[model samples]
Target: MAAYGYFLSCEEFSPSQLLEQARMAEQAGFEALAISDHFHPWNDEQGQSAFVWSMIGALSQVTSLPVTTLVTCPTVRLHPAINAQAAATSAVLTDGRFRFGIGTGEALNEHILGDAWPEASQRMDMLEEAVQVIRELLTGEQVTHHGPHYTVQNARIYTLPEQPVPIYVSGFGPQAAALAGRIGDGFVTMTPDADLIGRFRSAGGGGKPVIGGLKVCWDTDRDRAVKTVHRLWPNEQLPGELAQVLPTPRHFEQAAELVTEEMVRKATTCGDDPDEHITAVRAYTDAGFDEVYVNQIGADQRQFFDFYRTRVLPDLPRSR
Candidate 1:
């Protein structure tokens, strides 16, 4: 069955606001939640970035919906061992309603510790090894290891959930998706691309869950919504590997200046029309995604939730 979730954007919101959003999400009939982990906002215009672990702890207290990190990089800024410990504790806090989503990570977040950013291929290798180490530690056993990218010495996670935490791997293309199929508990991707989902399953993903996420702006004025997205998330429309390699918020801001209002309108569903919002979400369901998370890209969060609750959510195809 397909489940709908809400996305909590750490870069755009404070920890307290996120907790409130989680509560509102459950009230608005969202079944799950996805949160982003960032060291810095995509650009200064997007503003705040909070520690995701602390926000996750708070989310566990406020809501019962299953929570997953949309994608966290355990390879660089933080060691896999520490990530394992954090994930274990979060599983306990959420009372086992937790999924750990991981990726190769962007330079904007991972390069903070003065670590040199490796090439994309090297980062992918590191991510795979990191997942291996984290899975071992999540079993509540002592782990000692040395790998090409990371090392763990006699580390064990004492606090763990009763069941194993599911680790979902995120990717943008076939190479990383194939790795996810082989090593991840599930798969995560940003687009509602059916071909990618098909590739993941064919590459040994089998019956594991595939999660997708996208942003939408709900307002009476479509033009205003477009401008809002243009101002706040032009980073979303960047092409190629810019999102992965950009090292600072300022760099992203410079890059995002190239994004036009038309691009934001073309990429995200904006405005109050229930039909538009419905179509945006149905794309994921049609693509065979097991779970889909929607992010409200502007300040009209309450309005967006109300729109979903009273109009959009009820009309969505239930069986897809």
Candidate 2:
């Protein structure tokens, strides 16, 4: 069945705040939870980036809902071997409820290492290699790998769960989606793009689940919510390859200046009415997503949960 989930922007809330939100989300009937894994908030104004791993540990204890990273980059800030170990432990802690969702990454987060950011093609290569390394390590066998981007010697995860954690890969374009289909157990993308989903399945994803998410805001004042989203997440509206190539948050902020609040409002659903949120989610459902997750942007956490549970969830058609 298609699953309904919520995406938590970890950088936007304190750990305690997130713990509360998770509990509320569970009680409100969300089937799963996906959290953003970023070393830094896209901009400092967004305010928080509590280490995601630590937050995940706390989340496992606070709620019964399954938690996964919306997408984490295993090739850069953290090595695949270490990531594998972390995922294994998290899976055990969550009682096999963890899914490792990963992607090629953004310059805003990965470029902090002072390493020259490779081109997309190279990054994909690194991702493929990283996935192999991670999978091998999860086997609970000694692994020694010498790859173009990574090397691990005699590594074996001692804290692995009874089952290997499923890896869901996020992609935007056709090539990346195809890569996810070929290598990932499931496919993840933010866009509600049916063509991309078809390409992924055609490229060998088979019957694996497809997950997509969109941002929304639940507020009595729609205009204010749109303005707030654009002010804080203007980077969402920047088009083209610039997002991939921008080297710094300042660059992002500069480019983001060109995106108007209207653009954000047009792209996202923001309003007091839960129907608006349901319509936004329906776009993803109609686009052929196996699962659609909604992310409530800005604060107003309690109101957002209540809006979804009382007004939106009841109206959504059950996934077939």
Highest TM-score model number:
1
- In model 2, state the lDDT of residue 86: 88
The lDDT for every candidate, in the order shown, is 0.91, 0.87
For 1-320, candidate 1 gives per-residue lDDT tens digits of 58899999998887888888898999999889999999999999889999999999988888999999989999989999999999999999999999999999999998998999999889889988998899899989999999887889988889889999999999889998888888888999999888888888888899999997999988899999999999999999999999999999999999988999999988899999898898889999989998989999888888888889999888776634
Per-candidate alpha-carbon RMSD to the true structure: 1.1, 1.2
How well does candidate 1 score on lDDT at residue 153? 93
Q: Which stretches of candidate 2 lie over 4 Å from their true place?
A: none
What's each prediction's TM-score? 0.98, 0.97
Q: How close to the true structure is residue 172 of candidate 2, measured as C-alpha lDDT?
A: 94
Q: What is the lDDT of candidate 2?
A: 0.87
Clashing pairs in 1: none
Provide the lDDT at 246 for model 1.
90
